[model samples]
Target: MDAVERLRRLCIDDPVDDAADDPGWSDALDAHTVSLVRIGALIATDAPAASMRSVIDEAVTAGASLQEIVAVLEGLIGDVGLPRTVAAAPRIAAALGHGDDLVTDAEI
Candidate 1:
Protein backbone atom coordinates (compact mmCIF):
# COMPACT_ATOMS: atom_id res chain seq x y z
CA MET A 1 0.00 0.00 0.00
CA ASP A 2 1.03 3.57 -0.66
CA ALA A 3 1.58 6.24 1.97
CA VAL A 4 -1.88 7.69 1.41
CA GLU A 5 -3.57 4.35 1.76
CA ARG A 6 -1.60 3.61 4.89
CA LEU A 7 -2.56 6.94 6.40
CA ARG A 8 -6.21 6.45 5.50
CA ARG A 9 -6.28 3.02 7.02
CA LEU A 10 -4.52 4.13 10.16
CA CYS A 11 -6.75 7.15 10.65
CA ILE A 12 -10.22 5.90 9.96
CA ASP A 13 -12.00 5.08 13.25
CA ASP A 14 -14.97 3.36 11.67
CA PRO A 15 -15.38 1.13 8.66
CA VAL A 16 -16.12 2.88 5.40
CA ASP A 17 -19.69 2.38 4.24
CA ASP A 18 -19.36 0.02 1.32
CA ALA A 19 -21.25 1.07 -1.79
CA ALA A 20 -21.48 -1.10 -4.82
CA ASP A 21 -20.45 0.55 -8.06
CA ASP A 22 -23.21 1.49 -10.49
CA PRO A 23 -21.96 1.07 -14.01
CA GLY A 24 -24.56 3.51 -15.34
CA TRP A 25 -23.19 6.40 -13.32
CA SER A 26 -22.13 9.16 -15.72
CA ASP A 27 -18.96 9.94 -13.82
CA ALA A 28 -17.28 6.63 -13.27
CA LEU A 29 -14.80 6.54 -10.43
CA ASP A 30 -11.73 5.05 -11.98
CA ALA A 31 -8.32 4.85 -10.34
CA HIS A 32 -7.20 8.17 -11.73
CA THR A 33 -10.42 9.97 -10.78
CA VAL A 34 -10.30 8.44 -7.33
CA SER A 35 -6.69 9.51 -6.94
CA LEU A 36 -7.61 13.03 -7.96
CA VAL A 37 -10.31 13.19 -5.31
CA ARG A 38 -8.03 11.62 -2.76
CA ILE A 39 -5.51 14.33 -3.40
CA GLY A 40 -8.13 16.98 -2.71
CA ALA A 41 -9.33 15.25 0.43
CA LEU A 42 -5.79 15.05 1.69
CA ILE A 43 -5.40 18.74 1.10
CA ALA A 44 -8.63 19.57 2.91
CA THR A 45 -7.82 17.44 5.92
CA ASP A 46 -4.43 19.10 6.52
CA ALA A 47 -2.24 16.33 5.28
CA PRO A 48 1.25 17.51 4.46
CA ALA A 49 1.32 19.89 1.50
CA ALA A 50 4.11 17.75 0.11
CA SER A 51 1.71 14.83 0.24
CA MET A 52 -0.63 16.66 -2.09
CA ARG A 53 2.28 17.39 -4.42
CA SER A 54 3.27 13.75 -4.48
CA VAL A 55 -0.29 12.55 -5.07
CA ILE A 56 -0.80 15.13 -7.79
CA ASP A 57 2.29 13.86 -9.58
CA GLU A 58 1.05 10.30 -9.30
CA ALA A 59 -2.39 11.29 -10.55
CA VAL A 60 -0.86 12.98 -13.57
CA THR A 61 1.29 9.94 -14.21
CA ALA A 62 -1.88 7.88 -14.03
CA GLY A 63 -3.48 10.03 -16.81
CA ALA A 64 -5.29 12.65 -14.77
CA SER A 65 -5.01 16.15 -16.23
CA LEU A 66 -4.41 19.49 -14.52
CA GLN A 67 -7.98 20.44 -15.31
CA GLU A 68 -9.23 17.33 -13.58
CA ILE A 69 -7.18 18.19 -10.50
CA VAL A 70 -8.60 21.70 -10.46
CA ALA A 71 -12.10 20.33 -10.90
CA VAL A 72 -11.60 18.09 -7.89
CA LEU A 73 -10.45 21.02 -5.80
CA GLU A 74 -13.29 23.21 -7.07
CA GLY A 75 -15.88 20.54 -6.46
CA LEU A 76 -14.53 20.13 -2.92
CA ILE A 77 -15.37 23.73 -2.04
CA GLY A 78 -19.05 22.98 -1.49
CA ASP A 79 -18.44 19.95 0.64
CA VAL A 80 -15.27 20.90 2.48
CA GLY A 81 -15.65 24.69 2.47
CA LEU A 82 -13.73 27.65 1.02
CA PRO A 83 -10.84 27.50 3.49
CA ARG A 84 -9.98 23.98 2.52
CA THR A 85 -10.09 24.85 -1.17
CA VAL A 86 -8.07 27.97 -0.48
CA ALA A 87 -5.59 25.97 1.58
CA ALA A 88 -5.09 23.59 -1.31
CA ALA A 89 -4.14 26.18 -3.92
CA PRO A 90 -0.50 26.51 -2.98
CA ARG A 91 0.01 22.79 -2.76
CA ILE A 92 -1.65 22.33 -6.14
CA ALA A 93 0.45 25.09 -7.65
CA ALA A 94 3.65 23.56 -6.37
CA ALA A 95 2.66 20.17 -7.68
CA LEU A 96 1.92 21.59 -11.13
CA GLY A 97 5.39 23.25 -11.16
CA HIS A 98 3.79 26.66 -11.02
CA GLY A 99 5.17 27.17 -7.56
CA ASP A 100 5.75 30.85 -8.10
CA ASP A 101 2.05 31.60 -8.19
CA LEU A 102 1.03 33.56 -5.12
CA VAL A 103 -1.93 31.70 -3.66
CA THR A 104 -4.03 33.83 -1.37
CA ASP A 105 -6.29 32.70 1.46
CA ALA A 106 -9.23 32.60 -0.96
CA GLU A 107 -7.41 31.81 -4.16
CA ILE A 108 -9.48 28.76 -4.96
Candidate 2:
Protein backbone atom coordinates (compact mmCIF):
# COMPACT_ATOMS: atom_id res chain seq x y z
CA MET A 1 0.00 0.00 0.00
CA ASP A 2 0.99 3.59 -0.51
CA ALA A 3 1.66 6.12 2.23
CA VAL A 4 -1.91 7.40 2.16
CA GLU A 5 -3.33 3.92 2.47
CA ARG A 6 -0.97 3.08 5.31
CA LEU A 7 -1.98 6.25 7.10
CA ARG A 8 -5.63 5.48 6.63
CA ARG A 9 -5.18 2.01 8.05
CA LEU A 10 -3.06 3.22 10.92
CA CYS A 11 -5.49 5.96 11.84
CA ILE A 12 -8.80 4.25 11.19
CA ASP A 13 -8.35 0.51 11.14
CA ASP A 14 -5.88 0.00 13.94
CA PRO A 15 -6.38 0.77 17.59
CA VAL A 16 -5.86 4.39 18.64
CA ASP A 17 -3.11 3.57 21.12
CA ASP A 18 -1.31 1.43 18.59
CA ALA A 19 -1.31 4.22 16.12
CA ALA A 20 -0.16 6.73 18.70
CA ASP A 21 2.72 4.57 19.78
CA ASP A 22 3.86 3.93 16.26
CA PRO A 23 6.12 6.68 15.04
CA GLY A 24 7.06 4.86 11.88
CA TRP A 25 4.47 6.66 9.82
CA SER A 26 5.43 10.19 10.79
CA ASP A 27 9.17 9.68 11.30
CA ALA A 28 9.97 11.26 7.96
CA LEU A 29 8.49 14.61 9.01
CA ASP A 30 9.57 16.90 11.80
CA ALA A 31 7.32 17.41 14.79
CA HIS A 32 6.37 20.87 13.61
CA THR A 33 5.16 19.56 10.28
CA VAL A 34 3.26 16.77 11.96
CA SER A 35 1.51 19.18 14.30
CA LEU A 36 0.62 21.56 11.53
CA VAL A 37 -0.82 18.72 9.49
CA ARG A 38 -2.88 17.70 12.47
CA ILE A 39 -4.30 21.19 12.58
CA GLY A 40 -5.23 20.91 8.92
CA ALA A 41 -6.85 17.55 9.54
CA LEU A 42 -8.87 18.99 12.38
CA ILE A 43 -10.12 21.79 10.18
CA ALA A 44 -10.90 19.49 7.29
CA THR A 45 -12.90 17.23 9.54
CA ASP A 46 -14.84 20.03 11.29
CA ALA A 47 -13.61 18.73 14.62
CA PRO A 48 -15.13 19.89 17.89
CA ALA A 49 -14.01 23.21 19.30
CA ALA A 50 -12.82 21.54 22.47
CA SER A 51 -10.47 19.33 20.48
CA MET A 52 -8.70 22.32 19.00
CA ARG A 53 -6.78 23.30 22.12
CA SER A 54 -4.59 20.24 22.39
CA VAL A 55 -3.83 20.07 18.69
CA ILE A 56 -2.91 23.75 18.54
CA ASP A 57 -0.97 23.41 21.75
CA GLU A 58 1.02 20.56 20.28
CA ALA A 59 1.73 22.63 17.19
CA VAL A 60 3.00 25.49 19.36
CA THR A 61 5.10 23.17 21.47
CA ALA A 62 6.62 21.84 18.29
CA GLY A 63 7.73 25.39 17.44
CA ALA A 64 5.01 26.37 15.04
CA SER A 65 4.38 30.11 14.93
CA LEU A 66 0.88 31.55 15.05
CA GLN A 67 1.28 32.55 11.42
CA GLU A 68 2.11 29.00 10.40
CA ILE A 69 -0.88 27.65 12.25
CA VAL A 70 -3.15 30.20 10.63
CA ALA A 71 -1.58 29.42 7.30
CA VAL A 72 -2.58 25.80 7.66
CA LEU A 73 -6.18 26.88 8.11
CA GLU A 74 -6.01 29.29 5.22
CA GLY A 75 -4.25 26.85 2.95
CA LEU A 76 -6.88 24.25 3.52
CA ILE A 77 -9.64 26.53 2.25
CA GLY A 78 -8.92 25.52 -1.32
CA ASP A 79 -8.98 21.83 -0.54
CA VAL A 80 -11.52 21.70 2.27
CA GLY A 81 -13.73 24.54 0.98
CA LEU A 82 -14.41 28.00 2.38
CA PRO A 83 -17.24 27.08 4.71
CA ARG A 84 -15.26 24.38 6.48
CA THR A 85 -12.31 26.68 6.88
CA VAL A 86 -14.56 29.46 8.15
CA ALA A 87 -16.30 27.13 10.56
CA ALA A 88 -12.92 26.00 11.83
CA ALA A 89 -11.60 29.53 12.32
CA PRO A 90 -13.29 30.19 15.65
CA ARG A 91 -12.03 26.95 17.09
CA ILE A 92 -8.52 27.56 15.81
CA ALA A 93 -8.55 31.12 17.13
CA ALA A 94 -9.71 29.98 20.55
CA ALA A 95 -6.98 27.38 20.64
CA LEU A 96 -4.36 30.03 19.89
CA GLY A 97 -5.66 32.23 22.76
CA HIS A 98 -7.38 34.77 20.54
CA GLY A 99 -10.82 33.45 21.32
CA ASP A 100 -11.96 36.78 22.72
CA ASP A 101 -11.20 38.54 19.47
CA LEU A 102 -14.03 36.68 17.84
CA VAL A 103 -16.48 38.25 20.24
CA THR A 104 -14.98 41.74 20.22
CA ASP A 105 -14.61 43.18 16.75
CA ALA A 106 -15.63 43.18 13.15
CA GLU A 107 -12.72 44.91 11.51
CA ILE A 108 -13.15 42.96 8.34
**Residue-wise C-alpha lDDT for candidate 2, range 11-106, written one tens digit per residue:** 776634445566654667899999988899988898987787899999899999988987898899899999989888887787788878774444
Q: Each prediction's TM-score against the native?
A: 0.64, 0.76
Q: Model 1 off-target regions past 4 Å?
A: 1-29, 102-108
TM-score of 1: 0.64
Error of 1 at 8 (Å): 18
RMSD of 2: 4.3
Clashing residue pairs in candidate 2 are: none
Off by over 4 Å in 2: 1-20, 104-108
In terms of lDDT, the poorest run of 10 residues in model 1 is 17-26
lDDT of 1 by residue, 1-108 (tens): 344554485488632333234322224567686777678779679677678878888898889987888888888889889987777777788778876666644542
Candidate 1: give the clashing pairs.
none
